[model samples]
Structures are given as C-alpha cells and as structure tokens.
Target: MSSVSYHISNLLEKMTSTDKDFRFMATNDLMLELQKDSIKLDEDSERKVVTMLLKLLEDKNGEVQNLAVKWQNNRHTRHYQWREKKPKYNKGG
Candidate 1:
C-alpha cells in the first residue's frame, strides 16, 4: 500500500487531470487505498482533502462530480466514526 500522504497528494493533483478516465482511476485508487491499514493522516490533512473534494463535487463534468461525491461521503463517514471514537479530555477547573 502507498503512503496516505503520497496518495492524497497524487489524488489532489490528478483530480484536476484533463483525462476523465485517469481522474476516475486515481480517485478510485485513493479511495481503496484509504481503506487499508497503513494510511495514517492527521486531522488537518483530512480536512484539506475534504475541502478539495467539495470543490471537485462542483465540477461541470457529471462523472467527476459523482466521483467527488463518492470520496466526500466516504471521508465524511470516516470522520464521523473518528469523532465518535476520539478520546474526550478536560482540564481541571
């Protein structure tokens, strides 16, 4: 499995790719790889990816928009789960 950072960077670049097939392939690959165990990323990087994907969702091309939505939803789901499981801490008053 490729590094999450590398895949994210590649996906961000390829999301703007001129070739529709390539863009689709790259997006799908990124999504699949994200499901693997080794792709670690901090919250900020995840947010950046979500923002980028939200922009892609507005693309004029139907296929691109569809793929964007797919990634966005998957990321959203992951974030939701993460937030639910994250440890809650509070400082003394």
Candidate 2:
C-alpha cells in the first residue's frame, strides 16, 4: 500500500503523460493489493487509495474508465457493507 502511495506521488508530480492506461493500471494494481488480507492499513491510507481510484475512473479513455468503474463498484459494495455494520458496546456501558 505504501508502494502504491509512492507511485501515486510520482504520478502526481509529473507534468506530462497523463496517460489513462497507465493510471488505470496503477489503480488496478492497488485494488488488487488491497484485496489481500496480509496488507494491513489505516483508514487514511484506505481513503487515499479510494480517491486515486476515483480519479482513474474519470480518465478520458473509455476503456480505462469502464474497467475502473467495474473495480469501483466492487469496492463500493465492500466498503458499504463495512460501514453498515453496527458498532458494538460493552454490556455495562
């Protein structure tokens, strides 16, 4: 995940080459890595990843946008379910 942040930082720093395919590939890779349970992360890191993925979805290339949307949809479902879970309190609270 930190590696993805590194790539995203580099991509943001560049002036030229806003190639949609490149961005899309990077987003896809991040999403793939995020699916692994071994990759522990905090809420801030997760939010940053989601933000970058959304940007890739808005890329000019239609194919890239379509792929991003598919991935985004899957992400949305998981995220929504996680958010929807009710918080638990201690019995004495």
Q: TM-score for each prediction?
A: 0.76, 0.63
lDDT of each: 0.75, 0.63
lDDT (Cα, tens digit) per residue for candidate 2, span 18-80: 775566565556567667656655667666666766776677778767766887888878777
Q: Which has the greatest lDDT?
A: 1
For model 2, give the 10-residue run with minimal summed lDDT. 8-17
| lDDT for 6 (candidate 2) | 66
> What is candidate 1's CA lDDT for residue 34?
75
